[model samples]
Target: NAGVTQTPKFRILKIGQSMTLQCTQDMNHNYMYWYRQDPGMGLKLIYYSVGAGITDKGEVPNGYNVSRSTTEDFPLRLELAAPSQTSVYFCASGRQGAEAFFGQGTRLTVV
Candidate 1:
């Protein structure tokens, strides 16, 4: 089964455009998260969900939103994107204290 998948491996966004990064997991995990890593930096949480229909904001949620509507899907929405939003987006899933499986990542460059 696919552990975690993120679409559009790379994207270039102009200022003020919007996009959605898709994430899915087939492991039936209850915890899912969206994180962004700037060049040569650690991952910062943008949003997370404990289960379907339950989402919460994390460390960095500005200009971003999320919805978990099913057991396997957690999508991150970037609205009114800005140059500051340029980063590598990664989707992850796992139990607490467990190893989280990360997506290949979506590289977004907002110019």
Candidate 2:
């Protein structure tokens, strides 16, 4: 089974469009995180889920939302797309104190 998976590796959205980036892990991880990396910038945390039915906002959660209905899935939704939100998003899952398994990443461009 795959350790972690993310759909729509690349996408371009309009100024006001919306989309959900899908993430799933087969490792039954209790911690899942979403991060975005802009050009020439470091990764910024967007949202995270500790376990099933428990989710929390990260540093840059303003324009995004996440839901963790199951331990294996944590999807990120982007509302009201904007050019400033263009970046590569990564989904990661791991245990409490171990290394996380990351998805290939979704490249989003808002034009």
Candidate 3:
């Protein structure tokens, strides 16, 4: 079941440009999360949702937005991109005590 899928494996955005990173999971997990990793750093949570229609901010919520309208999809929106926003973004889903399934990742570069 395509555990977790992220679209546009890679992208480059100019300063001030905006884009949405798409993620979808077929595992039917109720918990979904968005995270970002900078070079030589651990993943930092960006946003997460316990279930559809319920979302919460994480460590770094600035310049980003997310929504969970269904169990299968969670998209991350970046507005007015900046160089500091360049990083590898990941989407994950899982149960409370189970291991999470992560997407291949989206590498974004803000120039």
lDDT of each: 0.94, 0.94, 0.96
- Clashes (backbone N, CA, C under 3 Å), per candidate, total 0, 0, 0
Could you arrange the candidates by lDDT from highest to lowest?
3, 1, 2
How do these models rank on TM-score, best leading?
3, 2, 1
Q: Candidate 3: which pairs clash?
A: none
Give the TM-score of each candidate. Answer: 0.96, 0.97, 0.98
lDDT of 2 by residue, 31-97 (tens): 9999999989888999998899999989999989999998988999998999999999999999999
Model 3, clash count?
Answer: 0
What ranges in model 1 sit over 4 Å off?
none
Q: Lowest-lDDT window of 10 residues in candidate 3? A: 93-102
Candidate 3 residues lying further than 4 Å off, grouped into runs, are none
Q: Cα RMSD (Å) per model?
A: 0.9, 0.7, 0.7
Candidate 3 per-residue C-alpha lDDT over 22-74 given as tens digits, one digit per residue, 9 for 90 to 100: 99999889999999999999999999999999999999999999999999999
